[model samples]
Target: MPPDALALYATVILLLPMACFFLSSPTFLLVGLEIPEVTQLLRGLFNGYFIVMCVAGVASAVAYVISGRPVFAVGALAVAAVAVMARRWFLQHMDVELQARAAGEAAAVPRLRALHLKGMLLNGILLATVIANVPLVV
Candidate 1:
Protein backbone atom coordinates (compact mmCIF):
# COMPACT_ATOMS: atom_id res chain seq x y z
CA MET A 1 0.00 0.00 0.00
CA PRO A 2 1.08 3.57 -0.71
CA PRO A 3 2.14 5.94 2.06
CA ASP A 4 -0.51 8.52 1.18
CA ALA A 5 -3.25 5.92 1.31
CA LEU A 6 -2.08 4.79 4.69
CA ALA A 7 -2.12 8.34 5.98
CA LEU A 8 -5.59 8.90 4.63
CA TYR A 9 -6.88 5.80 6.38
CA ALA A 10 -5.23 6.93 9.59
CA THR A 11 -6.80 10.36 9.35
CA VAL A 12 -10.21 8.87 8.65
CA ILE A 13 -9.85 6.58 11.64
CA LEU A 14 -8.98 9.52 13.87
CA LEU A 15 -11.87 11.65 12.64
CA LEU A 16 -14.55 8.96 12.83
CA PRO A 17 -15.30 9.31 16.54
CA MET A 18 -15.67 13.04 16.18
CA ALA A 19 -18.12 12.54 13.36
CA CYS A 20 -20.14 10.16 15.50
CA PHE A 21 -20.03 12.57 18.44
CA PHE A 22 -21.34 15.43 16.33
CA LEU A 23 -24.47 13.44 15.66
CA SER A 24 -24.74 11.78 19.05
CA SER A 25 -24.16 14.68 21.44
CA PRO A 26 -27.19 16.85 20.73
CA THR A 27 -29.46 13.94 21.55
CA PHE A 28 -28.02 13.89 25.04
CA LEU A 29 -29.69 17.25 25.57
CA LEU A 30 -33.08 15.68 25.18
CA VAL A 31 -32.55 12.69 27.44
CA GLY A 32 -32.78 12.57 31.19
CA LEU A 33 -29.36 11.68 32.44
CA GLU A 34 -30.84 10.35 35.63
CA ILE A 35 -32.04 7.29 33.82
CA PRO A 36 -29.75 4.37 34.47
CA GLU A 37 -29.90 3.14 30.88
CA VAL A 38 -29.13 6.58 29.52
CA THR A 39 -26.11 6.89 31.74
CA GLN A 40 -24.97 3.47 30.67
CA LEU A 41 -25.22 4.37 27.00
CA LEU A 42 -23.40 7.63 27.56
CA ARG A 43 -20.62 5.91 29.41
CA GLY A 44 -20.30 3.33 26.66
CA LEU A 45 -20.05 6.03 24.04
CA PHE A 46 -17.27 7.76 25.97
CA ASN A 47 -15.38 4.54 26.52
CA GLY A 48 -15.48 3.69 22.82
CA TYR A 49 -14.45 7.20 21.82
CA PHE A 50 -11.32 7.10 23.91
CA ILE A 51 -10.40 3.64 22.77
CA VAL A 52 -10.71 4.66 19.14
CA MET A 53 -8.74 7.82 19.75
CA CYS A 54 -5.87 5.82 21.20
CA VAL A 55 -5.85 3.35 18.35
CA ALA A 56 -6.21 5.99 15.66
CA GLY A 57 -3.48 8.11 17.13
CA VAL A 58 -1.03 5.22 17.14
CA ALA A 59 -2.06 4.26 13.61
CA SER A 60 -1.55 7.83 12.42
CA ALA A 61 1.83 7.95 14.07
CA VAL A 62 2.87 4.78 12.35
CA ALA A 63 1.58 6.05 9.05
CA TYR A 64 3.51 9.28 9.45
CA VAL A 65 6.70 7.41 10.17
CA ILE A 66 6.18 5.21 7.13
CA SER A 67 5.53 8.27 5.02
CA GLY A 68 8.74 9.89 6.24
CA ARG A 69 7.05 12.65 8.16
CA PRO A 70 8.65 12.27 11.55
CA VAL A 71 7.42 15.62 12.86
CA PHE A 72 3.88 14.58 12.09
CA ALA A 73 4.70 11.26 13.69
CA VAL A 74 5.52 13.08 16.89
CA GLY A 75 2.30 15.04 16.63
CA ALA A 76 0.35 11.82 16.18
CA LEU A 77 2.07 10.33 19.19
CA ALA A 78 1.09 13.43 21.15
CA VAL A 79 -2.50 12.90 20.13
CA ALA A 80 -2.35 9.33 21.38
CA ALA A 81 -0.72 10.44 24.60
CA VAL A 82 -3.42 13.00 25.18
CA ALA A 83 -6.07 10.38 24.55
CA VAL A 84 -4.44 8.04 27.03
CA MET A 85 -4.26 10.66 29.76
CA ALA A 86 -7.66 12.11 29.01
CA ARG A 87 -9.34 8.70 29.07
CA ARG A 88 -8.07 7.94 32.56
CA TRP A 89 -9.04 11.36 33.86
CA PHE A 90 -12.38 11.52 32.10
CA LEU A 91 -13.48 8.06 33.10
CA GLN A 92 -12.44 8.53 36.71
CA HIS A 93 -14.37 11.76 37.05
CA MET A 94 -17.32 10.28 35.23
CA ASP A 95 -17.42 7.28 37.53
CA VAL A 96 -17.37 9.64 40.51
CA GLU A 97 -20.27 11.63 39.10
CA LEU A 98 -22.17 8.46 38.28
CA GLN A 99 -21.67 7.16 41.78
CA ALA A 100 -22.77 10.43 43.30
CA ARG A 101 -25.84 10.51 41.10
CA ALA A 102 -26.68 6.98 42.13
CA ALA A 103 -26.33 8.02 45.76
CA GLY A 104 -28.96 10.75 45.26
CA GLU A 105 -26.80 13.80 44.86
CA ALA A 106 -28.70 16.64 43.21
CA ALA A 107 -25.71 18.16 41.46
CA ALA A 108 -24.33 14.98 39.97
CA VAL A 109 -26.31 14.98 36.76
CA PRO A 110 -25.40 18.56 35.94
CA ARG A 111 -21.79 17.83 36.68
CA LEU A 112 -21.92 14.91 34.27
CA ARG A 113 -23.37 17.17 31.62
CA ALA A 114 -20.58 19.64 32.12
CA LEU A 115 -18.04 16.89 31.75
CA HIS A 116 -19.74 15.74 28.56
CA LEU A 117 -19.55 19.22 27.12
CA LYS A 118 -15.89 19.50 27.95
CA GLY A 119 -15.22 16.22 26.20
CA MET A 120 -17.07 17.49 23.17
CA LEU A 121 -15.03 20.68 23.23
CA LEU A 122 -11.83 18.70 23.33
CA ASN A 123 -13.10 16.67 20.40
CA GLY A 124 -13.53 19.83 18.35
CA ILE A 125 -10.04 21.01 19.13
CA LEU A 126 -8.59 17.65 18.19
CA LEU A 127 -10.57 17.50 14.96
CA ALA A 128 -9.38 20.95 13.96
CA THR A 129 -5.78 20.10 14.78
CA VAL A 130 -5.94 16.91 12.75
CA ILE A 131 -7.52 18.62 9.76
CA ALA A 132 -4.92 21.36 9.87
CA ASN A 133 -2.21 18.77 9.42
CA VAL A 134 -3.86 17.15 6.41
CA PRO A 135 -2.55 19.59 3.85
CA LEU A 136 1.00 19.07 4.98
CA VAL A 137 0.57 15.37 4.57
CA VAL A 138 -0.84 15.89 1.12
Candidate 2:
Protein backbone atom coordinates (compact mmCIF):
# COMPACT_ATOMS: atom_id res chain seq x y z
CA MET A 1 0.00 0.00 0.00
CA PRO A 2 1.08 3.52 -0.68
CA PRO A 3 2.17 5.70 2.26
CA ASP A 4 -0.43 8.33 1.40
CA ALA A 5 -3.30 5.92 2.04
CA LEU A 6 -1.98 5.07 5.48
CA ALA A 7 -1.43 8.73 6.29
CA LEU A 8 -4.95 9.61 5.20
CA TYR A 9 -6.41 6.84 7.32
CA ALA A 10 -4.48 8.00 10.37
CA THR A 11 -5.52 11.58 9.78
CA VAL A 12 -9.18 10.58 9.56
CA ILE A 13 -9.02 8.68 12.84
CA LEU A 14 -7.23 11.50 14.64
CA LEU A 15 -9.68 14.13 13.40
CA LEU A 16 -12.80 12.21 14.40
CA PRO A 17 -12.68 13.23 18.04
CA MET A 18 -12.16 16.88 17.14
CA ALA A 19 -15.14 16.77 14.82
CA CYS A 20 -17.27 15.33 17.59
CA PHE A 21 -15.99 17.91 20.03
CA PHE A 22 -16.89 20.73 17.71
CA LEU A 23 -20.37 19.34 17.21
CA SER A 24 -20.88 19.07 20.95
CA SER A 25 -20.72 22.84 21.48
CA PRO A 26 -23.80 25.03 21.15
CA THR A 27 -21.94 27.71 19.27
CA PHE A 28 -20.72 25.14 16.77
CA LEU A 29 -24.11 23.44 16.28
CA LEU A 30 -26.35 26.41 15.54
CA VAL A 31 -27.98 26.24 12.15
CA GLY A 32 -30.82 28.31 13.60
CA LEU A 33 -31.91 29.61 16.99
CA GLU A 34 -33.41 26.27 17.92
CA ILE A 35 -31.02 23.50 18.91
CA PRO A 36 -31.81 19.86 18.16
CA GLU A 37 -31.90 17.18 20.86
CA VAL A 38 -28.59 15.67 19.79
CA THR A 39 -26.79 18.95 20.43
CA GLN A 40 -28.75 19.91 23.53
CA LEU A 41 -28.00 19.20 27.20
CA LEU A 42 -26.91 15.71 28.32
CA ARG A 43 -27.85 14.14 25.02
CA GLY A 44 -25.10 16.15 23.36
CA LEU A 45 -22.59 14.72 25.76
CA PHE A 46 -23.63 11.13 25.09
CA ASN A 47 -23.93 11.62 21.36
CA GLY A 48 -20.57 13.30 21.04
CA TYR A 49 -18.79 10.65 23.07
CA PHE A 50 -20.42 7.68 21.33
CA ILE A 51 -20.04 9.09 17.83
CA VAL A 52 -16.36 9.71 18.44
CA MET A 53 -15.94 6.13 19.65
CA CYS A 54 -17.81 4.74 16.67
CA VAL A 55 -15.73 6.81 14.27
CA ALA A 56 -12.53 5.63 15.88
CA GLY A 57 -13.73 2.01 15.82
CA VAL A 58 -14.67 2.08 12.14
CA ALA A 59 -11.48 3.91 11.17
CA SER A 60 -9.27 1.52 13.08
CA ALA A 61 -11.13 -1.48 11.67
CA VAL A 62 -10.47 -0.20 8.17
CA ALA A 63 -6.81 0.36 8.93
CA TYR A 64 -6.42 -3.08 10.48
CA VAL A 65 -8.13 -4.81 7.59
CA ILE A 66 -6.08 -2.87 5.06
CA SER A 67 -2.76 -3.31 6.88
CA GLY A 68 -3.47 -6.88 7.99
CA ARG A 69 -2.77 -5.96 11.59
CA PRO A 70 -4.93 -7.56 14.30
CA VAL A 71 -3.18 -5.51 16.93
CA PHE A 72 -4.85 -2.39 15.55
CA ALA A 73 -8.23 -3.99 16.09
CA VAL A 74 -7.37 -4.84 19.70
CA GLY A 75 -6.12 -1.30 20.28
CA ALA A 76 -9.26 0.14 18.76
CA LEU A 77 -11.43 -1.99 21.00
CA ALA A 78 -9.44 -0.84 24.01
CA VAL A 79 -9.90 2.75 22.93
CA ALA A 80 -13.66 2.30 22.54
CA ALA A 81 -14.02 0.79 26.00
CA VAL A 82 -11.90 3.51 27.52
CA ALA A 83 -13.98 6.16 25.78
CA VAL A 84 -17.21 4.74 27.15
CA MET A 85 -15.80 4.62 30.67
CA ALA A 86 -14.47 8.13 30.31
CA ARG A 87 -17.85 9.34 29.14
CA ARG A 88 -19.48 7.97 32.24
CA TRP A 89 -16.83 9.66 34.36
CA PHE A 90 -17.40 12.87 32.44
CA LEU A 91 -21.11 12.80 33.15
CA GLN A 92 -20.45 12.35 36.83
CA HIS A 93 -18.06 15.23 36.90
CA MET A 94 -20.35 17.34 34.80
CA ASP A 95 -23.05 16.76 37.36
CA VAL A 96 -20.67 18.05 40.01
CA GLU A 97 -19.94 21.07 37.87
CA LEU A 98 -23.62 21.80 37.50
CA GLN A 99 -24.08 21.55 41.23
CA ALA A 100 -21.20 23.89 41.86
CA ARG A 101 -22.50 26.36 39.33
CA ALA A 102 -25.90 26.30 40.96
CA ALA A 103 -24.18 27.17 44.20
CA GLY A 104 -22.60 30.25 42.55
CA GLU A 105 -19.23 28.70 41.80
CA ALA A 106 -17.26 29.02 38.60
CA ALA A 107 -16.72 26.12 36.21
CA ALA A 108 -13.40 24.32 36.32
CA VAL A 109 -11.05 24.34 33.34
CA PRO A 110 -9.45 20.99 34.17
CA ARG A 111 -12.54 19.12 33.03
CA LEU A 112 -12.20 20.43 29.50
CA ARG A 113 -8.44 19.92 29.54
CA ALA A 114 -8.89 16.34 30.68
CA LEU A 115 -11.29 15.61 27.84
CA HIS A 116 -8.75 16.79 25.25
CA LEU A 117 -5.97 14.96 27.06
CA LYS A 118 -7.95 11.74 26.93
CA GLY A 119 -8.37 12.10 23.17
CA MET A 120 -4.64 12.68 22.76
CA LEU A 121 -3.86 9.66 24.89
CA LEU A 122 -6.15 7.47 22.79
CA ASN A 123 -4.57 8.74 19.58
CA GLY A 124 -1.07 8.10 20.90
CA ILE A 125 -2.00 4.58 21.95
CA LEU A 126 -3.55 3.80 18.57
CA LEU A 127 -0.62 5.27 16.64
CA ALA A 128 1.96 3.34 18.65
CA THR A 129 -0.02 0.10 18.33
CA VAL A 130 -0.43 0.48 14.57
CA ILE A 131 3.20 1.43 14.02
CA ALA A 132 4.33 -1.61 15.99
CA ASN A 133 2.41 -3.84 13.57
CA VAL A 134 4.10 -2.57 10.38
CA PRO A 135 5.18 -5.59 8.38
CA LEU A 136 8.27 -5.75 6.19
CA VAL A 137 7.53 -5.52 2.49
CA VAL A 138 10.32 -7.65 1.17
Candidate 3:
Protein backbone atom coordinates (compact mmCIF):
# COMPACT_ATOMS: atom_id res chain seq x y z
CA MET A 1 0.00 0.00 0.00
CA PRO A 2 1.02 3.60 -0.48
CA PRO A 3 2.33 5.55 2.51
CA ASP A 4 -0.75 7.75 2.61
CA ALA A 5 -3.03 4.75 2.59
CA LEU A 6 -0.99 3.15 5.37
CA ALA A 7 -1.23 6.34 7.41
CA LEU A 8 -4.97 6.41 6.97
CA TYR A 9 -5.20 2.82 8.12
CA ALA A 10 -3.12 3.57 11.18
CA THR A 11 -5.26 6.56 12.00
CA VAL A 12 -8.43 4.54 11.76
CA ILE A 13 -7.01 1.74 13.89
CA LEU A 14 -6.03 4.18 16.62
CA LEU A 15 -9.10 6.43 16.53
CA LEU A 16 -11.83 3.81 16.42
CA PRO A 17 -10.91 2.31 19.77
CA MET A 18 -10.63 5.76 21.29
CA ALA A 19 -14.08 6.56 20.05
CA CYS A 20 -15.46 3.35 21.52
CA PHE A 21 -13.78 4.06 24.83
CA PHE A 22 -15.40 7.45 25.06
CA LEU A 23 -18.78 6.08 24.14
CA SER A 24 -18.72 3.32 26.77
CA SER A 25 -17.09 5.20 29.59
CA PRO A 26 -18.61 6.54 32.81
CA THR A 27 -19.83 9.52 30.82
CA PHE A 28 -22.65 7.25 29.83
CA LEU A 29 -24.04 8.00 33.28
CA LEU A 30 -25.00 11.40 31.98
CA VAL A 31 -27.73 9.65 30.02
CA GLY A 32 -29.47 8.91 33.34
CA LEU A 33 -28.91 5.18 33.56
CA GLU A 34 -28.24 3.23 36.72
CA ILE A 35 -24.71 2.18 37.62
CA PRO A 36 -25.29 -1.54 37.14
CA GLU A 37 -26.95 -0.92 33.82
CA VAL A 38 -24.04 1.18 32.66
CA THR A 39 -21.63 -1.50 33.81
CA GLN A 40 -23.54 -4.15 31.91
CA LEU A 41 -23.65 -1.99 28.81
CA LEU A 42 -19.94 -1.25 28.99
CA ARG A 43 -19.15 -4.92 29.47
CA GLY A 44 -21.04 -5.77 26.32
CA LEU A 45 -19.55 -2.82 24.46
CA PHE A 46 -16.04 -3.88 25.41
CA ASN A 47 -16.62 -7.37 24.11
CA GLY A 48 -17.06 -5.86 20.67
CA TYR A 49 -14.39 -3.22 21.19
CA PHE A 50 -11.75 -5.81 22.01
CA ILE A 51 -12.55 -7.72 18.86
CA VAL A 52 -12.33 -4.51 16.86
CA MET A 53 -8.99 -3.71 18.44
CA CYS A 54 -7.64 -7.12 17.59
CA VAL A 55 -8.67 -6.77 13.97
CA ALA A 56 -7.41 -3.22 13.70
CA GLY A 57 -4.13 -4.14 15.34
CA VAL A 58 -3.49 -6.96 12.93
CA ALA A 59 -4.39 -4.79 9.98
CA SER A 60 -2.12 -2.02 11.18
CA ALA A 61 0.74 -4.46 11.66
CA VAL A 62 0.33 -5.82 8.18
CA ALA A 63 0.14 -2.35 6.77
CA TYR A 64 3.31 -1.36 8.56
CA VAL A 65 5.10 -4.42 7.28
CA ILE A 66 4.02 -3.67 3.76
CA SER A 67 5.25 -0.12 4.19
CA GLY A 68 8.67 -1.39 5.33
CA ARG A 69 8.29 -0.18 8.88
CA PRO A 70 9.24 -3.17 11.03
CA VAL A 71 9.21 -1.28 14.34
CA PHE A 72 5.67 -0.08 13.80
CA ALA A 73 4.69 -3.59 12.82
CA VAL A 74 6.04 -4.91 16.09
CA GLY A 75 4.24 -2.20 18.01
CA ALA A 76 1.00 -3.10 16.29
CA LEU A 77 1.51 -6.75 17.12
CA ALA A 78 2.10 -5.79 20.75
CA VAL A 79 -1.14 -3.85 20.71
CA ALA A 80 -2.93 -6.90 19.41
CA ALA A 81 -1.43 -9.03 22.17
CA VAL A 82 -2.53 -6.51 24.76
CA ALA A 83 -6.01 -6.52 23.28
CA VAL A 84 -6.18 -10.30 23.59
CA MET A 85 -4.92 -10.22 27.14
CA ALA A 86 -7.36 -7.50 28.10
CA ARG A 87 -10.23 -9.49 26.65
CA ARG A 88 -9.22 -12.86 28.11
CA TRP A 89 -7.76 -12.01 31.50
CA PHE A 90 -8.84 -8.56 32.58
CA LEU A 91 -12.41 -8.82 31.40
CA GLN A 92 -12.85 -12.26 32.91
CA HIS A 93 -11.43 -11.12 36.21
CA MET A 94 -13.74 -8.14 36.23
CA ASP A 95 -16.72 -10.37 35.59
CA VAL A 96 -15.70 -12.73 38.35
CA GLU A 97 -15.27 -9.83 40.75
CA LEU A 98 -18.63 -8.45 39.79
CA GLN A 99 -20.26 -11.78 40.45
CA ALA A 100 -18.48 -12.11 43.75
CA ARG A 101 -19.62 -8.67 44.78
CA ALA A 102 -23.17 -9.61 43.85
CA ALA A 103 -22.80 -12.63 46.08
CA GLY A 104 -22.04 -10.30 49.03
CA GLU A 105 -18.26 -10.57 48.96
CA ALA A 106 -17.58 -6.96 49.90
CA ALA A 107 -13.89 -7.20 49.11
CA ALA A 108 -14.64 -7.89 45.47
CA VAL A 109 -16.00 -4.39 45.04
CA PRO A 110 -12.63 -2.75 45.48
CA ARG A 111 -10.96 -5.32 43.30
CA LEU A 112 -13.46 -4.71 40.55
CA ARG A 113 -12.98 -0.99 40.80
CA ALA A 114 -9.23 -1.45 40.62
CA LEU A 115 -9.57 -3.59 37.53
CA HIS A 116 -11.67 -0.90 35.87
CA LEU A 117 -9.10 1.71 36.70
CA LYS A 118 -6.31 -0.46 35.36
CA GLY A 119 -8.25 -0.92 32.16
CA MET A 120 -8.67 2.82 31.84
CA LEU A 121 -4.98 3.34 32.39
CA LEU A 122 -4.11 0.71 29.82
CA ASN A 123 -6.36 2.37 27.29
CA GLY A 124 -4.74 5.69 27.99
CA ILE A 125 -1.29 4.25 27.46
CA LEU A 126 -2.36 2.58 24.25
CA LEU A 127 -3.83 5.81 22.97
CA ALA A 128 -0.67 7.68 23.82
CA THR A 129 1.45 5.13 22.05
CA VAL A 130 -0.62 5.43 18.92
CA ILE A 131 -0.55 9.19 19.06
CA ALA A 132 3.20 9.21 19.49
CA ASN A 133 3.66 6.95 16.49
CA VAL A 134 1.29 8.76 14.19
CA PRO A 135 3.77 11.36 12.96
CA LEU A 136 6.47 8.78 12.26
CA VAL A 137 4.09 6.42 10.53
CA VAL A 138 2.63 9.17 8.43
TM-score of each: 0.92, 0.49, 0.82
What ordering of candidates by TM-score runs from best to worst? 1, 3, 2
lDDT of 1: 0.85
Model 1: per-residue Cα lDDT over 25-136, one tens digit each: 7788799899989988888888888888888888888887887778888988888898889888889999999999999999999999998888888888988998887787
Cα distance off (Å), candidate 1, residue 104: 0.8
Model 3, 31-106: lDDT tens digits are 4222557667766766776788888888888887887787888888888888888888877986887788777887
lDDT of each: 0.85, 0.52, 0.74
| Number of the top-ranking candidate, with lDDT as the measure | 1
lDDT, model 2: 0.52
Badly placed stretches (over 4 Å) of model 1 are none
**Root-mean-square deviation of Cα positions for candidate 2 versus the true structure, in angstroms:** 6.9
**Candidate 2 local lDDT, 1-138, one digit each (tens):** 664466446545744664545444434333321223322354355547555875686676667556665555565666667667766776666556445544555434344334445544554564454445443211
Better of 1 and 3 by lDDT: 1
Worst 10 residues of 2 by lDDT: 30-39
Q: Comparing candidate 1 with candidate 3, which one achieves the higher TM-score?
A: 1
Q: How much is 70 displaced in model 1, in angstroms?
A: 1.1
The best-first sequence of candidates by lDDT reads 1, 3, 2
Note each model's CA RMSD in angstroms.
1.4, 6.9, 2.7
